[model samples]
Target chain A: SQTIHQWPATLVQPVGSPLSLECTVEGTSNPNLYWYRQAAGRGLQLLFYSVGIGQISSEVPQNLSASRPQDRQFILSSKKLLLSDSGFYLCAWSEASAVYEQYFGPGTRLTVT
Target chain B: AQSVSQHNHHVILSEAASLELGCNYSYGGTVNLFWYVQYPGQHLQLLLKYFSGDPLVKGIKGFEAEFIKSKFSFNLRKPSVQWSDTAEYFCALSTLVNFNKFYFGSGTKLNVKP
Candidate 1:
């Protein structure tokens, strides 16, 4: 069975602080990774996606950026956080054969104050 | 505007009541459809998916959805609802043109009353 793990289930960060969220998948290889942000009353927004290591695509350009450092490890980082950056962040993985079907992680709740 | 649209933002239903949630997409060409559920305090999980073959697909938890190609609509249905069904439902679509990208609708919050 495949499992996706995200760190810092919940975090509270002050404005102008740096942000880092990690996501790693197990039991799968060469999986496509995605980063999404979900806000109240708003649907999930795709922030970035990666097909392979060091390859990243930005869906919605903002202050956030994503990097695939390893085959199974993905990192979302920001030099300085904004109040609008606070939301529920989700990490998802899909097999290359079936990119349409995705498996999501438990998600990280970051509150920027 | 969102490419995918979920008409129901919030719904309150009693146990045993029938469920029908409307989902519409604005993309053309071959597309894959999916329905996901997020129970309170839990990760989002796929309820059902439609790639091809049957237009009507059955998902877990006694839920089903019918895809109407002409209408560009894939509506979710449930014969009877339960208290445990109270959760958030999201409708998503991915086109073959960009299989790696998915567009999600504004989720519908279902509150099932006991």
Candidate 2:
């Protein structure tokens, strides 16, 4: 069975602060990872996706960035956060062979004050 | 451009009631379809998916969906829904050439009362 872990489950950050969210997957290797953000009452917006280590594609250029430091480890970071960055961030993984069905993590709820 | 549309933004039903959520996609080429469910405070889970072969796909929790190629629609159905079925449902689509980028619908919030 494959499992994805993300943390911290919830965070409260002040405006203009830095941000870091981590996601790790177990029981799978060389999986494609993705980062998505959902604003309140809105659908998900794809931020970034990584095919392999050090390879990332940005869907929307914004204040956030994603990195695949390891085969199973993905990180979302921002040097300085904005108030618009407050939302629920989800990390997902899909097998390289069948990449259509994506498995999502519990998600990180970030509140910018 | 590929996009997915979920017809209902929100639906309320009683337990044991039938369920049918509409999903339509706009894509010309061969594409894969999927229905995902996100229970309150839980991650999105695959309820059903359509890749090839059979147009009718059955998924977890006694849920099913039919793919109509001509209509370009994949509507999810359940004979009887429970209170536990209250959650947000999302329809997604991916083309063969752009499989990495999955387009999602706005989602439908289904509330099943006891």
Candidate 3:
């Protein structure tokens, strides 16, 4: 069984604050990682995806960036958060053999004030 | 870029009613289709997927979807939906050209009254 973990489950930050969200997957190796954001009344948007360590692709360039430091660990970071960055952040992992069969982790609700 | 479209934005139905949600995709190449469900305040869960072969694909919890190649449609269906079936359903598309990118629909909110 594969399990994905993400934290902090919720966050409240003032404008210009730095943001860091972590995601880890257990029981799988060499998996593809992805970061997605869901805004209010909008569908999920693909922010970034990583095929392997040190390989990241940005789908929608913005204030946020993603890093795959380890095979099973992925991190989303922002130097300075913007008001528009407030949304639900999700981390997903899929087997390399099947990219679209991705599974999601419990999302982090970010609130920027 | 490929795109997915879900016909129903919101649907309210009583328990035991039949369920059918429309999904259509626009892409030039061969594609993979999926249906994911998200309960309130929860992350998305894969309900089913269609890769190749068998236009009709059965998924978890008595849910099924048919992929119509000519129409580019993959509509999800369930015979008797329970109250627990209340959730938002999303249709996704993944093409071979851009396998890493998955396009999602806006989603259809299903509310089943007990």
Point out the worst 10-residue segment of candidate 3 chain A by lDDT.
A37-46
* lDDT (Cα, tens digit) per residue for candidate 1, span A1-113: 99999998999999999999999999999999999999988889899999999999999879998999899999999999999999999999999887758999999999999
For model 3, what is the alpha-carbon lDDT of residue A84?
Answer: 93
lDDT of 1 by residue, B5-100 (tens): 998999999999999999999987998999999999999999999999999999999999999999999999999999999999999999888899
Ranking by DockQ: 1, 2, 3
Runs in model 1 lying further than 4 Å from the true structure: none
**Location of the lowest summed lDDT over 10 successive residues in candidate 2 chain B:** B1-10
- Clashing pairs for model 2 are none
lDDT for A37 in candidate 1 is 96
- Candidate 3 retains true contacts at a fraction of 0.62
In model 3, the Cα lDDT at residue A103 comes to: 94
Taking all chains together, each candidate's TM-score versus the true structure is 0.98, 0.97, 0.96
Q: Give one digit per residue, the lDDT tens place, for model 2 in B1-114.
A: 888888799999999999999999999999999999999988899999999999999999999999999999999999999999999999999889978988889899999999
Clash tally for model 3: 0
Residue A59 CA displacement from its true place in model 3, Å: 0.3
Once superposed on the true structure, which residue ranges of model 3 sit more than 4 Å away at CA? none
